[model samples]
Target: MEWLLTPGPVQLHPKALEALSRPQLHHRTEPARALFLEARSLLKRAFGTEGEVLVLTGSGTLAMEALAQNLFAPGERVLVPVYGKFSERFYEIALAAGLRAERLDLPYGRVPRPEDVAQRGFQGLLLVHSETSTGALVDLPALARAFKEANPEGLVGADMVTSLLVREVALEAYGVDAAVSGSQKGLMCPPGLGFVALSPRALERLKPRGYYLDLARELKAQREGESAWTPAINLVGAVKAVLEAVMPHLEAHLALKAWQNALLYQVGEALGLRPVPEVKSPAVAAFYLPEGVPYGAVKEAFARRNAVIAGGQGPLKGRIFRLSLMGAYDRYEALGVAALFREALADILPAS
Candidate 1:
């Protein structure tokens, strides 16, 4: 109802909404199997990979957890490049999954060059291709190459949830071992499906781990057109509808990114709210507030104007607010949000 702006729950298409209302099919039904298989096939194009695409019913983070569980065993050393909050997650997931994670820390606004991975020789690497918190997009391909050079036999997992379709990433071409993404963002679907794709090398590297989040078992079941368990039938249908109808226009998506970010940059310049210089992402814009204005005031200003946006996360909380343009954001809609942003920012700036 309100001008939908935050990243995850984007404006759903009427068709997708209708798909949710379709009769729930048994997970093993012939029709469900057909749609399920179709969605998996579509994901390969979505991720630019010919490898198996695993569609599991969970949040995007679950895809990361699945990789952590199956790919690395306890005490195996992994490298995590931490610059933003989401990147820090790799370290946490690694620790939780029993892998010993070493980190290459960079300043909040800075990005590590892709070749930086070649300098480290950890057994595996958990890389956040897109730093959601800081709106910094990392160089995934370079990192992938460097990882191979440094640890040819080790694994490399990418969290592509925010960057998957916003830009061009060839998962299979880049030789990345595994990657995770979600139904939300570029896919423009509801938030119930977590998608993963793995290279043959990644599968070979996977060791025995947890059961439910197991990618191997899920892949086998998915290939047969059924989930290993009761799936999110309606949500999967939504994914099918959106991917079939919306996600193919890569050029349009790139233009959408450009349009939204151009407006954001204009508004930011007017208000003197600047994104961190070096590594801004196409998916979202992260900007610091005007001097002396609290984070709550900016949020309140948008609320009063019939709009809402995202706040900062972790240590960056209270310092930056994120405007996500990942899903279903149109030029006109973004312009309207920019208008509201200008007014809100004007009110928050110091009376000089």
Candidate 2:
């Protein structure tokens, strides 16, 4: 059995794998449309939104591009809160799409305060609900209130790629205008399928259809119970199966995550390992290496024992290591991984 601890492309449930192996269906066929509609309905329930859900055959980045390309006109200004690698990408995509983008940079492992964004005037606001790279969780409700108060015209958007099914986002209740996620993260399916939900007010900001990334066309096709282009039949089928299986047990899934994180923290404390922050994510836990111990040595030592742990991204590389507790992980698995990590660290850096 391969143990995966990385963020995206997380460990898949056996049922989801079985769903992917089912007989292929044509995208234009009646069965395909029914499946598409079923998936869309389930997605709404998953996102806890009454707004429209758009299914795309690309990654989560495609959903982001679609929103940027269709929602705003040229020269529109957007404010992106940059805390990790994925959050920073939102700014890059908006700029590349020809929109005026400004960034509010926050150090990794710390959430941005609402007052910080309230000072900046912008038409659109972007957030990464869970920054997997840094294991930082933003306060969605506070951020939404601050953005709306800062600029009434601002449409709030979030990248829920890492937090979706694992945590409670409640986009409608939280005042989020638009949000996006991929199938692989919390949805417990494979990559290649992107999910997007937009508020009616946010949808009203769209310009005329100019490209395939147009949300208008996607929405129109979705209204007819289909996708604009041929859909990813296998992946959509997997998503439908996964959602059906997990919907009733979502709370249990999140509880398992909590249990795993707590177990990891217990083991880390016993082993004298330092957590990166006082507030840790239930989705993932990032730890700082003991002083005088290099991250590379610890990573290789873990790899030798057939366990995979993630290293930090961008500037934090070589300074920290991340272990994902999302998906179907259990307390035993968490304990095993924690033992392996502690053993690895002990081998690399002895007590002094």
Candidate 3:
């Protein structure tokens, strides 16, 4: 495939792919335990947190749900700023977990300001640092600082699935209590594993609401180099491989953001496509599809070239389309993809 540019399950790095296909190991064994421990340590660096990073055997949503259920008690007022689909998912998870979710709903492409959120005042704040559906990246450090100033005891949780490796998420420096991420997007691995990086305060607040997704139980076991249940052994191996490659030379990994933004902006400008969100995310870019251009035509055009791009989700679906610059894409590959993006656009747009 020339591209696997949908929001998640992106093309994995060769090392991660090799690790994913390696012979399965028993989770109780010594080697498996060592792998778990190594991956957890690397993940802490990825999240930029001195606290615990819990590896879960599910998708990113599972981590988000875990944070919702664990970080706050029932009936605690949690402020959720809903701007796009993923942010809305955070709010939904909070409500489902029996928290008093106070939503500050904004239009799909609008980025929520920190002051506005702090003004609302709640016991906890659940936010999507990068909203993939609309390609909006929030100012997380500012938001976290503001929230901490207003409600010092309040916990702040972030969905960093799209922002994890693409952007520098300094959880400790930013004062984020908890953050959730997945393997597929910035980790350059296949889907399966979810991670929750928690501050010491967040760890203390953890009250397990369920058995399978219980953070408290997982934390106890993980600290001892084990999993609470049968783990995704292959996926864990893949994560360790990717992190080993990334953590040593971290600056290059973080540079993916700037490279992606440049590619997306150049493509959008050359093709006359308007970006959906005012503040774009380097992880993904969404644009309003040209008038009279159905998403089907766009998909088919890209498919012809063995390239894949994503369409918008929720209310923006059919009206907009998305492109991703995640995975282990370097400058040369980005240039090639940008060229292919132009060709794909040429194939779809009517003859001028």
Candidate 4:
């Protein structure tokens, strides 16, 4: 079987795939409303919050832009901690939204300390819980607490696109004002649905931004089990299936993390590859290629073996490679990936 090891748009879970192929339902019907509402509840559990979770018909970036639009007015100063590509995207989005985005730039592999962020006197904070590009996981709870302590009246928004179902996040406990995520990464669904989970405080702070992304209007419509516009009906069904059929297995989550750590250490050591991040992520792993090993050759070799891997992006181009463990891979499938990875590597390395 072919392996999809890229960071996003992961191989869909079987249940989600099946659900996606099911007959579509009209968005205004009672059955459709129930499905949407149930999915929203499951999303709340996934985010570990009691607040409202609004579903939108776009990718994760849509939710990011929506947060920037609704949470802060134009010219409001917002602190963005940029460590990798995805975090930097938030910084750009803030600037594009007309916010005075102040970036606390750090190296690719290192994250900003919570104590350090508290000193940045911005009216709002934008966070990336897991940087998929560098495979670095941030201490989100600590950062959220620090931000709240420093700016009691300020808002804290998180882009949890890669971390939502892959890692544990307590939005309310950590005082995160809002968190945005997508269906493709941790949720093991297609790329159509974007979710925003907001605290009561954040909900109260929401205002009209634009027609499609206005969170206030979306919130009101979603509360009554409806959408303000036509929704991604099939994708919503797929998400509902994933949340109901796949998400309740707590043991599977624990097992996946343990498996991922073991696999990364074992495979990385065997290949003489060093991890790129100071704090690695369970969802994505980035490693520096061994000396003289061409990134293109290695990636092409994997592709020839029907194993899809990803190269670095932006400034990281050709410097590192990333492997993702975002889908619902069982023990045998995980072992298959490890074996295929070794075989693919052997195809490129010099003969012993």
Candidate 5:
């Protein structure tokens, strides 16, 4: 009955878990190839794109690195809209790639506006669709359109690690040249599978810097029912199960998220806690701590109950806490989390 309601590496679906425990299948086998390709098609639907989807053996960050390596040419200038920890990672990634990366640092929980970088003459725009640290979901379509309008020659890239399946987004419609996601989040599978869906334009032309993450090579291999290297067969199996058994119910899943979001907000308000002031996320809810409450103490309290939620990160640390209702979670699990959170809050911030 213990719940793990943190953002990434969420609770796995029963079927995915069961599938993960099965014996490995050779990566190049027909059955394995079919599973991998099937997962890709499911992922295309998840991303709402007819574009090419490539899966790699790494975390979501790996896909981000792949995008930076492949897309950012040396001496290129890129715009990153920063609001939380993950967004900061993109800025850092661009800098590490030796690109002239500039960012519009906005307040936490605030979505970046289209006008924020209207005149920025950058060659690319990097964005995180959901700021997990602050539990904020940005207007990705608007930002993508804005970037496209401002710099038609430039490309739009998105990190959908937290939003891929749990949140609604159409990569093609949003003009996202590349979008990255991980199995640990919305896909409700084991960690290690990183996915990137690329528009045809991006696929036709990208100078990948890294040998391991060459989308050209990976895509070719995948198309031929192969891998560039030994694949993570177990994790791929888990993802295949997720794609087969879970993703088909996307509408119901989204409805469940909406319901959970409203219920959590109602529960938090009843306990005198409030979400960060902005357009909150349906996947993760970041709540401002009550006055006189100690963050570490409350986190430890949850741990003592054999459950683990997340404390905020970076600038929001110790002030806001996050709860993720991703993966195979439902109202029954929500009720458990709510009860534990209530008890912990009462213990930490008793009537005053």
Candidate 6:
């Protein structure tokens, strides 16, 4: 009866849950291989990529680490644009991996202009397609084109963690060298498995890959319908179910998101609550709280209503809150949550 509106570890479909309930199979057995192949094929279809989709047994951060380890050598310069919490995580990963990293820091919700990044001499660029923390979306095509034109040899990696299956991003057409996403967001599954898709340019640049975080090795194994390490069998099975359910309803999904976004605007206007960027995410919508209302109180109030919403991350912790519109929920459920949120605000904020 709990409604999840958080970005990651989103609401799972009943069918996906049922898929996970299936009895476990040997990871090396034929049944497991068949499941793996089915999940991999569905992933490629979801991403619209002919390139290999490597499934990692960890969260999306694992894929980010794989990208850093596989694509660049130590001391190679990488440009990362910091617009939100997740984007900053990419920078942290790059630095920890010992890669020389340059950051283009934009205030949360503001997109860094392409010209701002062109001056940096970087061998790779890390971008977050949608900044879930502040609900800001970067111009994916413009960012990709900017890096490609600046350094054709450079790899363009993206954290499509929040926007992958929910929104349409033409990875091949946009020239994105590599991208990563978790199973939870848009995939309608639980968070355990991660997906990474690499372009030809990225594949060509891969060097001696580390054992666990090696994209090339994973891709090689995945192409042969295997995994380099023990795969998440249950999560993979759940992903297959989620993909099967979503494939038929892709159009309905988009339409629902469109409707939800409009309703969010309407509700926010009624409550005098302003969106952080004045822009919305088809995946998640973040709003600024009215003065004198505590974010924690509002969250608790929503919990009482049997709904959960996410609060802002990092510097925006108290001032902003986020509502995820992605995953299995429909407009009716979201509107119910929105109604509770409006009521919570009314209880806390003074009348105009």
Candidate that would win on TM-score: 3
Q: Assess the local accuracy of residue 67 in candidate 1 as a C-alpha lDDT between 0 and 100.
A: 80
Tell me the lDDT of candidate 4.
Answer: 0.86
What clash count goes with each model?
A: 0, 0, 0, 0, 0, 0
How should the candidates be ordered by TM-score, best one leading? Answer: 3, 4, 5, 6, 1, 2
Which TM-score value belongs to model 3?
A: 0.97
TM-score of each: 0.95, 0.94, 0.97, 0.96, 0.96, 0.95
Residue-wise C-alpha lDDT for candidate 2, range 24-85, written one tens digit per residue: 88888888889889989888888888888899889999988877777777788998888888
Query: Model 4: residues >4 Å from true position, as ranges?
Result: none
Q: Identify the superior model by TM-score, candidate 3 or candidate 6.
A: 3
Off by over 4 Å in 3: 350-352
lDDT values, one for every candidate: 0.79, 0.81, 0.87, 0.86, 0.83, 0.81
- What ranges in model 1 sit over 4 Å off? 350-352
Error of 4 at 297 (Å): 0.9
Task: Provide C-alpha RMSD values for all models, in order.
Answer: 1.7, 1.9, 1.3, 1.4, 1.5, 1.6
- 172 Cα displacement, candidate 5 (Å): 0.8
Candidate 1 residue lDDT tens string, 192-250 = 88888887777667675687897778877888999887889888888888778756687
Candidate with more favorable, higher TM-score: 4 or 6: 4
Q: What is the RMSD, in Å, between candidate 4 and the native fold over all Cα?
A: 1.4
lDDT for each residue of candidate 6 in 1-352, tens digit (9 for 90 to 100): 8878787778888878999888887888888888889888888777766676789999999988888878889999999989889889999999988899998888887776777667547899999888888888788778778777888778888888888777776567777878899988888888898888876666777864688887767877887678999888888989988888887777777778767766776787678888886345677878887777789987887788787888989989999888886868877887886787678677677767
Model 6 shows how many backbone clashes? 0
Which candidate, 1 or 3, has the higher TM-score?
3
